[model samples]
Target: MNRFLVLPLALPMVALAAEPAGQATTPLAGSDMAGQLGQLLLGLLLVIGLIFLLAWLLRRVQQLAPRGGQVIKLLASQSLGPRDRLVLVQVGNEQILLGLSAGRITPLHVLKEPVHLADAEPATPEFAQRLMELLGKDQKDKS
Candidate 1:
């Protein structure tokens, strides 16, 4: 009984081993280590090529259309609290209330002087330039 059971298991293994030695030693195309290595390298190169292509496309698109105001709200919302600086100037009976924050501040306009608040424009080129210069100076100072 034991011999019969052992024969069934051993016979298959013996038959497997009886195949030609050359056939057993031969490697399949898929199993070739160098082929696998080359395939892996090719896949990596393909990924890198795709990344460079995307970058080139993005650069071309950017060149074709120059865009601005991508993050105006982000920049405008940086200051959490009251973003505007309020200045109260009392000249005689009348009181001048001025708000200076972000795009409101200027270089030439004397914030120290107590002037009338009736004459004030929200959008001024001179004001914007002065504000830009002031912001640049502030950034430089911080850095």
Candidate 2:
């Protein structure tokens, strides 16, 4: 059994030792390596670019779907805890305040009179404008 096992393993080594020494060992040429690397990098970049393009197209397609005709509209939502929230939802003309917990949603209040929201300028400015105003204020204060 020992002889049988040793013969099988040693036969391949004997065959390798008997091969001619003049044969080149390198599988790929030096000049071809750079071209192969460039092709590989280009292929990787193409796959990544295709992924980004698909994501952008999916977002645009989602935005194109009709969104104005929904029956239930979420007016506002405020988080009370990690898993609890207060949500104001408008179903048709009636607005309802809901207390949302982990397990269940309970109706807190129902507004009998709908409050009219005027189309005046927004109460808060845009984030960039607000940041610029704050920085200006800070600079003025320092001076």
Candidate 3:
């Protein structure tokens, strides 16, 4: 068994060593190495691009997830600690105060009269508007 395995492996090495003296190694060895390196880099770039595509698809899928209905609306949230928060929620005519911590949500109280917070600014500006604002600031700063 050992001889059979040894012979099979040795035969290839022996054949490789038996090349004719007149036929030296190919002169395009360097070019072959460069081609192989380029092929490797292209494969790496393709894999990275595929990963980014998958990540973008995942974000879009999550954003498009169905929310059922707007039965419950969050009024406001205040962070008490790093992992704890007080959340005010409204459902129909009822308002609830809830305490939220890691892995648990506890109802703190039920408001007889609903507490409404002051409304914040309207919807945020898109990328173009934000970019124009930044450019205007830069121009003003340079003046």
Q: Rate the local accuracy (lDDT) of all candidates.
A: 0.61, 0.85, 0.86
lDDT of 2 by residue, 36-100 (tens): 99999999999999999999999899899997889987777779999999988889999999999
lDDT of 1 by residue, 12-47 (tens): 898878886657577674568788899999999999
- Please estimate how well model 3 matches the true structure, expressed as its whole-model Cα lDDT: 0.86
**lDDT (tens digit, per residue) of candidate 3 on 23-97:** 557687788889999999999999999999999999899889876567887887889999999988889889999
lDDT, candidate 3, at 91? 92
Which ten contiguous residues of candidate 2 have the minimum total lDDT? 115-124
Q: Is candidate 2 or candidate 3 better by TM-score?
A: 2
Task: Give candidate 3 regions above 4 Å deviation.
Answer: 1-13, 16-25, 66-71, 91-93, 102-104, 118-143
> How displaced is residue 98 in candidate 3, in Å?
1.4
- Window of ten residues with lowest summed lDDT in model 3: 117-126
Q: How high a TM-score does candidate 2 get?
A: 0.57
Clashes of each: 0, 0, 0
